[model samples]
Target: MASSSTLSRRSLLKVGGGLGLLAAASQITPAWATGKGTKVSVNSPEQLLSLSAVDLSQAIRGGSVSCSEVMTAYLDQIETYNPTYNAIVSLRDREQLMDEASRADTELQRGQYRGWMHGFPHAVKDLAATKGLKTSLGSPILKDWVPGHDAIFVERLREAGAIIIGKTNTPEFGLGSQTYNSVFGVTRNAYNPDLCAGGSSGGAAVAIATGMVPVADGSDMMGSLRNPAAYNNIIGFRPSQGLVPFGPTKEVFYQQLGYEGPMGRTVQDTAMLLSTMAGYDSRVPLSQKSNPTSFAGNLDTNTQGLKVAWLGDFNGYLATEPGVLDVCEQALKHFNTIGGTVEAVDMKYPMEEVWQTWLTLRHFLIAGIASGLYSKESNRALMKPEAIWEIEGGLELSAMDVYKASKARTSWYHALDKLFDTYDVVALPSAQLFPFSADTHWPKEINGRTMDTYHRWMEVVTPGTLSGCPVANVPAGFDSQGRPMGIQLIGRNKEDLKVLKIAHAYEQAAKLTQTNPTLVKS
Candidate 1:
């Protein structure tokens, strides 16, 4: 068993001096938050370290703390922790970041508040290109590749006054569930440095978990955002399809599965980040005209009479680890305290078909994006095996396969629509297992069941991705091993607001987010 300690409710609050910042900003209890029966305690730096992106925004905007203070605090924490965690990579341009922060402070002094993200120093996932910063996509071929312009999401973040500190690590081409590549190495869990921080948003999640960033930019296709958030004990949301639009793409309508979204330590902070991300542009046909501002507004915490369907194991079909299921089940009971009803719902579908559909569609998009890179000898040599497999799988897909997968995806959406007709939300374990060894590759099995592919272990999230439903991963608690665990709050198609509201209510009831992980320095 892993060595661990328990954090009392009083000590958890004392770490942050209060719970206001974490309460709404995607909050959770880190495994090491305990002050007694443990070797570690929350130190003074953690006080500022625990503030959510929303709290930091308010504090910086309101002049409670200078931008330089916020910038230096996170940079100090990152410098202290990143060497061990390997969450952020390609560090450079700090002098520029310091200058921008000072300018932001000057602007604030003149009563010019840009927005919620004003003057905040944060990093984008290496998968997202940023101008002048090294955006490696975790691939060796792009090791020194710097984009001349920001990706759409990065552009939006900058527009909202977010300072791009650097890029977070990711799997090569964002191809796997684990954060690793030939470039930067694997990113470890914030709770335990030896355990895996779920990826390809792994670096982004760890960065936010350890105060490297208050909020971050992460993209999700197959649980990239949600899985890492679950592992890191933070909040990750995969908004409804078309809610966040990208640019300079040739295939918008056909390939909309992969999307860039926000990551934060709190839902309110996540929502605030989403406000800058969500917008409609004719350049991307799939863009939704959602009022992103609504996401940042007051979250409804009252769960009076909300019906929740506890679909543990997808009707006993998913091979979830016993301990993980237990944690999720315990979290479901918290719904009752918030006036939410829980009932077992047997999803009457062959669960494996969802995985099949996702594999086909996901590979098709990947192959399309990786089209010409393989032709170059240097690039082919730099490509990771999983990435090559994905590209090949996409290329091997037949027209019939595409047609069948598209039909299956449509059917899956209808099936979820039917399920939502009966219940407001469906709850399940975010990841099948808690954080595993960061030193190892993907788990080959779950509960003794062998996984067939490198990504098969992450099949649990495929349905949500396939259905295009809005899903949020909220921290449930921790496994006996002191690793993080979380529950997924899934809403109906495009019911993004309702999804967040239910997650907020559960967050309030669970009170897990109130605790944060204290780095157990060796």
Candidate 2:
């Protein structure tokens, strides 16, 4: 087992005190509670819920707000809106959360502030283990599993004074992009209600979008964070792999493709959350020790002179929606306005080969972790068909296959490195299409092109995933049907802050973050 205690004093202080303190101190007043002491804006639940973490923090710090008030507001919204979305699978102890808020207020009175998240309520994805909370990961096999310990990220968030209010839904074992399982039914998009929230972090995005939580933590492997963020018109950031730790557990496959990241309604809040979440973890072999810099710091830097390469389409592998590309092109013009130059570039790598390689590696890892489920009579019926297929695929892979996949990944990384040599950032459409119908697993056709596999339609993310680059989904604009669209900004490895800076600049320039989803209470 990896040792949590192995974290250096520098890392501990960074996680426990540094950027976290700054984050805690910065709060934005809830839009609903401006000037008037009462008259809460339940009228615009979606707009109220849309307030970013930074906005909430600013609100709390202005002395016009209390932690309990924010918590109650969100809880009320959840009650009103989550029934249709089925986003929040399990809620935290409400009374305890209120108590924590009261204590935060007390601390403020004594001038002992916990930080930006001190009184803010947040939710963790069901896939994450939260101590004393039932973390089902949307699977029946773990229905009764209550972890005795919090995942490292969860503990870190708690220590930063974030209120743990609930667990959002996920697919069983996070095997699929759609957020539905026998355990939690289905998580729907907050914008359309009829569309599915892109999964496995679907519920987290929905929670943020629907006002259930101001911000939430989500894990991404195959577009879980980005897809959902795009679907819901929010911010989802996937930091470079190993920037956040993966374990003190036996799950090595998850350690590779899977990553715990932050999802929020705004980029600054996502940056603040990442500042709190990123740090050295002795328990996770891949976790990296970050420099003592706030993720939100240096965001004021101008994008002028920043070199960006735009991959408008991935060599025709995936079809692009016209509106999605239109918004992305408009966003690119902002880079030029700020003095940054944009160029069209071809990735030149064989995406089909890379897709197959990723599947082979993914199968091996998922199967290895789920090997025990292969038995015929160990209540193995609890597993989903997708999970079983992935596991069996992994079981069939040879050592040579794994070796070849790794080599291919190396080649792909080299190709990306060459591209980054000329560009500070890479821009792409976050998704090939806007939010599709919730009932369908994947769209049969998009932009007149038929997709053979549910996951194949989302191949645009492979470049970032395979390269382990820092990628963020920034809300671009809405499509014709009012569904949100996003543009992804990918930065060089370890330059997550740079990507965030660019995203923040664009967010401010576009002012898209100011828009809220149209909420319909069920």
Candidate 3:
């Protein structure tokens, strides 16, 4: 499917510009606004929640269920469960969504159906600007700030006939994977509330996990997408950097690392979302031209003779919790059973250098985007300590440091290039640590080793983040305590379809996506 012509930054400003900001306060409030939905209740659309996006889309197209019915079901689910998980924040009035869905239903009745997302309820990452809705990006400084335009990807979703609902929580400015910010308190895991959901896509992941929302948009730089999917037992795909362009950014052509993509309960759903969120725009210089029609259309089920390598722990370079690797290793065995050869391969790259390069470049970008906040003590104080540290760390770095990091990044990609020549896909733990206490800021240490900072425990996702490769998270099952684990499926550069093909193969082989999280009865 071609991306909507409305996905340019110019289009964004025309719809909703991001300008309004609240006065500064050191003690910033979380952005989890509790807005009530329209009291219009329909018969339970609950069963529809069990269906995949592909099925739901077809059902809506075929008139098995009206768009209004599908949306009402999800709205009811959100109202009932959101208070429990705090995954959805800055929620829009349900009346607005119902109206949109009703219109969509009317359009379908008139044979004016849109695309796959014609009537689906979707929310982009809170970090993304939503035209009429408040987008705080989990930072209290931007609380009450409503954008006049939609982020490009968001507009793309809207044009596809998605009923834009609300925004999901994220770390302040999407800086961390933990998913907490001054604007939004911690988002809890679907399986266990005490544990973190994983972030900056944490809320999106949790929304999918808790049946709050079927599909959500997320950006992954340092595992923002994959880590949360692993923690919530869902699917998160980081498209090859330029395939799903940053849509809005200062430097588009050579962004060191970062991607905006889709996350959902199933890979097919993810592929469907990706098809809409992707396309080339000359406005985004780095955006690559490609027709994503085949992403969802050609989901090959055969993994016979695919070369899969499970690189557990980057040959012990990344600090990992004991059971995480075991979960991934077991996942590879499924590949082997499906006629795919899975083997453990030792990477011949300097792991420390890669980590350092990611940190240097990441903090550098964070520092620039957040520099305005640093100018004001109250705004800076509103940010988490790690965020301030990251800004300051970036400020302290010399051009030489960035150059060296870039050099390290080159070597790292080169090493992976060689590895990919031999392996079609590489599997690893999406995050080094399993879901941890939601109340806790970050894991201070893992496996008896001290983490350098709040997001240090998430280094396991760095490889894919830095490589600009297409990475998809597939459910690998749960741990001893029932916390979910996901294996990271890394395909060669821009091999987006190949990666999804194998992921679909694995999911079908194990029949894992059918499993759903059952919230504990209080």
Candidate 4:
């Protein structure tokens, strides 16, 4: 005779079909997650929610805390704060989640241990499929669509013992950095409810910032992860291209512009999540075959006499709002205190050429994926103007145009590669301006400069994105209006760990994550 908990566990296994299969196939056995490391006991939900993800993991694994209690604290936090931020959508039922948590505890008691994320509550970005959960991508056309399968990263997260709570908000088809759409409305900045949360990872960053989730997975095509992290004052890491297996999608090679990464309140948490999300999958031929566990190891590294190239406004080629550069410069000073020299380096590469290359490639890739939606008049009517513009721009491009863009992109890469010969990491502002009003669509101009395109204001992020290198957005502190900003620490290609090391050291020196968001505090 089977016990009720045993029956419930079996039912969960059936419900998580592919997830359960993946979990069994790749049982994550990291020493950091399962060790009887820290006996972290918490008396109240506040204390439990306050502990870092790493600490919480150890506490749950060591039996100092139960998964039900952790789930309860997170659920309470979400119930209280989610309404205001709109960071999480398609939220799961509380009773069902509690039952899952109870089953997780039962498994622990029976000595059937899972991985690091064992019993952790997690939410996938709206752009990624969440099996049973609706992945609206912030579009009303697909608002009711439920994915039957999870994205590769989501599958890995499930395999690592994460309970899928729901989906985070993103822009329509993740076309913009602002996280508002016809489906979920706007995802407010974690620091200020009235301001826009940068997207398409806006909801993911906000969820982490507000303690709604310990960590989150996000994709960055054009500063999606970095910009939102900057807005919310959290760590958003864009790993080296191909470092993380993204999809088993139809178009694999052409979709090189975007890559999924992790966001967290701290660098270690970001690194830990990255470790789980990375590694090769035969389905995704471009995925790296490196050991993912390497990222989960010690991040503390000596930064004595390290050379950092500060690409401020690309020598005034970029139009930045007032104080954006000053804040980033001040944040770079932390590297100096840590024995790393931050030198302002003028990029000799043609700035306009790089922007043109980005526009061409972005338009081509977006159009390739979205042409189906654009073909339908009813769907086109429901789509955002930015989506339509990208499709149309791509439709207008010739083979020669794409070839020229690719050539220019290669040239820009070589230029950045040349700088890497002298500098260990290249630094730039993660965004052009601080968080703007959630009511506004996109910035029309910056400092009296006319923006030609909807995403022109975000041109500052193109250099890092185009380099195909590892980039981490570290908090650059707040402006006069208390709006947050961040600076991008871009490292040489295939040096994801190096970037994380520098970010961790700078984080220790700056100690910006010590400040919680106003929403969370209240």
Candidate 5:
């Protein structure tokens, strides 16, 4: 817990206060609530921390576990493990969080329930604007900056009665896949402290995997949600572009590449959080008008004849490291076991052209977002080379260049559409390689091919991102070195529930989420 206001006697006071408050509240337990009979049997901090987000939410709502106990359990868990892994940054003071938890308990006693996540302690990704909390996008330039208002998604989280405890770490300006920045150092992998935690959702995924937070909000432009979930052995869902209203920012319409999504240890928790985060907001012009609460509905579905197209390595166009494909292929077999047919599909469109289109649109967006900082010599000195490269690439493009890139993007979308016409979902490896060295920024080579750009190693994620479809990263089993990996299940546009249902069914069949890292216990 990195806090400026670390009180010497705070932990003892919090524990005593939480117990006193919970005991007093227990005397007046409501008849409608489950009281002490909830299915979750939490006898210790480890037991409480081990409960899934959905289970914890149910326990809190049923009056089985008071909010203060939940808060204290998480705070202690964070104190025990966060220093070693660096999964969470800019954490609020423990005493203040405990106070908020007590208030939540009082509200429940008065029958003022908020939502599914009522009283759940949550940490927003550092990229999103969290009112009154530090929104340092892991950059030293605005390290002390705090927003006065919340981002639209943050507003949703607060409205659902979640107590904002802290901000999860992210790459500076979310420019790269690996989560490291000059401001807060690096976030280590959940499975292994020495390996890289993929980002810019790296901290959020690690927090969920390590039980520091129940569920977290993360944004994805190029596999920010999927890659980290794959690396951490968790579930990350990237919903369709406009399903979650992104900004309530200056640039909303043109900047459609990046999207806000949910990541959790289970598919149900991810879908539940998505229900809270998504919906139509009049503030965002491009926001979809569908019912977001429907995502929280029952995920059970019959995939008896579902058609899945395995676009493995894009017919060998992508250069993957040794064992990634094998692990994902093994995971794909679970779909077959669940009565879905899997077939290897060849690419109808040229992959290189798709890559080129991604580069152009990404550069254009990055330049538009970061050009002001790039214009200043002092700021350029503080930025990473990859950020500079993106800005420069965007600066060099002309109107005609952007127009042509948009046309290419449309063609790629059509190509994906054609696939969806035949198959229910398209599958790919979430990452090209397993967890790599955290000291090294990004992989220079995969197998023998050199990566041309900082993000080219993660080009496998772009098709789902480019098509504005719903993509969920489901846990594929670990590699020989105990390094975890995941596979992406891409559904047709706006078919978020279909993707989640298949992911839940696949998760049940795979049984990989049952495995926990050693650090989670320690």
Candidate 6:
């Protein structure tokens, strides 16, 4: 598979002529020819900015549009608004992107169209390497780092005919949930520029929410993917760990917790991206042995008889906002309305223990990957203090610490297994609050509860993370401030598609997809 960056370059070269055509069209035709005219009235910058991946895919497939046209519109939007949001770290070669899009159009004309993602523009989080594109991982120490090859997931996306536009920003080493670093500054939320876009997949979510791209690839470990999706009011799906190849190491203990998946404006688009991204890779030893299935197929499957267990508070570790529970509860009621059984369930576990175990395991794993950066002679000014702290924490962890944490993770999984036996799905607030100001990291205090760590505030997601369950974030509703919130639908182990189907069902019933960010012109 070609690297996303290579594919992006090829695309720009292929479509350069077509982009010239678009430019000429604008010169000769009305302003609407540039998508600037009032075919639709945009309420805010966000409304005009966000575009659904599925919609863009359909437009290209129907011949009503061309990939170059779509890419150009998005590039224009990024140029006009991205400076204020800092969502897109670097852009792909535009002429290269247009060239690849033209090829997609040629293929369509030749009856060689790929599926949903063909000709669709997308981005990957900066932490994921892309050959020829800077993969800084949000750390200044590796500011000039470029990968020799694309990450396996990026390869899959290119094979599916998706054009990789560029990379989004993230926290240094993806250590925190807020998208900020000394390397690329910070990625602010599309809904409110002063607020955070959420991280370490923050840039990906913001790009999708702000119309810079239709679909984006993001990796989630400790809610990096889900939190950002929730903050930006987009759909983010974290497939069952081994379902999407996350390789170079097969250790189920850590690999299962950190995996890359898809984020988009709608459930169908997210599922489409997931389908393209799934499948086994020999490099990922624990990868499942099965042909990748279409995640978008039969998504209208009825949920009438399904049993959904609603664990609202996760035994009270999560501090949910006032309307957060209400929005999710109302969404759950829709399941009942559709003939599904909804019941409250008790999820009893040692919350503090889980956090500690996760911290120990995560810190050790991250430090191990960054061990080379911590040499005595170079650690002085090269590494961020937080990165140093995490590395030191990892070095202090004995083998016994890893063993104990793994054991705790196993215990937690078993507890969840018992719960899954009684429920077809588990649901909860995607985050504890509506989108907060992007200016700060997750609130140190919420509802009068002091969160000791950045990850503590998002403890609600750890159950699924620890269990390795496939989870999807469905846009639930907005808070009083008009910021979006979502509900997480977690499937039984390996039942990834089923969870997506349920999310699709809820999406159809709620019609909440109509809500989009109002982009303010800078």
- lDDT of candidate 2 over 102-184, digit per residue (tens): 88888877877666677888788999988888988788888889999998888888887788887899988887678888877
Model 1 poorest ten-residue lDDT run: 9-18
lDDT of 3 by residue, 1-522 (tens): 111122121121112222212122223211111111122322347768877777677667766778888888888888888877888897788888889889998898788866778898887788887898898978788898998887778878888888888889888888777877766687888989888888889999999988877788999989988999999989999998788867566666556587789998888789888988898877687787987665756465545566666667765677888898777766666665556666666665678888888889988887877877888988887777888888999899898988888888877777777767777887788889888888777888889999987777888888888888899999888888999889899988888987887787777777777778887433
lDDT (CA) per prediction: 0.79, 0.76, 0.78, 0.86, 0.86, 0.75
Residue pairs with colliding backbones in model 5 are: none
Task: Rank all candidate structures by their lDDT, best first, as comma-separated numbers.
Answer: 4, 5, 1, 3, 2, 6
Residue-level error in angstroms, candidate 2, position 115: 2.2
Model 4 lDDT, full chain set: 0.86
- Candidate 1 vs candidate 6: the TM-score winner is 1
Question: After superposing candidate 4, which stretches have Cα over 4 Å from the reference?
Answer: 1-34, 520-522
Against the true structure, candidate 2 has what lDDT? 0.76
Distance from true location, Cα of 112 in model 6, Å: 4.1
Off by over 4 Å in 3: 1-44, 520-522
For candidate 5, lDDT tens digit of each residue in 288-323? 998876676667677677677788787579989989
Residue 486, candidate 3: Cα error in Å is: 0.9
Q: What is the lDDT of residue 54 in candidate 3?
A: 71
Model 2 RMSD to the real structure? 9.6
Error of 5 at 168 (Å): 0.6
Relative to the true structure, candidate 6 reaches a TM of 0.86
Q: Pick the candidate with the highest TM-score.
A: 4
User: Between prediction 5 and prediction 6, which has the larger lDDT?
Assistant: 5
Candidate 5 positional error at 71, Å: 0.5
Model 3 lDDT on a 0 to 1 scale: 0.78
Candidate 4 residue-wise lDDT, 1-522, digit = tens: 101111221121111111110011123445554456757788889998888888889889988889999999999999999989999999999999999999999999999877889999999999998788888878888999998999999999988889999989999999888999888788999989999999889999999999999899999999998999999999999999899977878887768889899999999899999999999999888888888887777777767767787777876899999899888877876776777766667666779989999999999998898899789999999988889999999999999999999889888888888888887888889999889999989999999999999999999889888888999999999998999999899999999988898898889889999889767433
TM-score of each: 0.90, 0.87, 0.90, 0.93, 0.92, 0.86
Candidate 1 residue spans exceeding 4 A from truth = 1-46
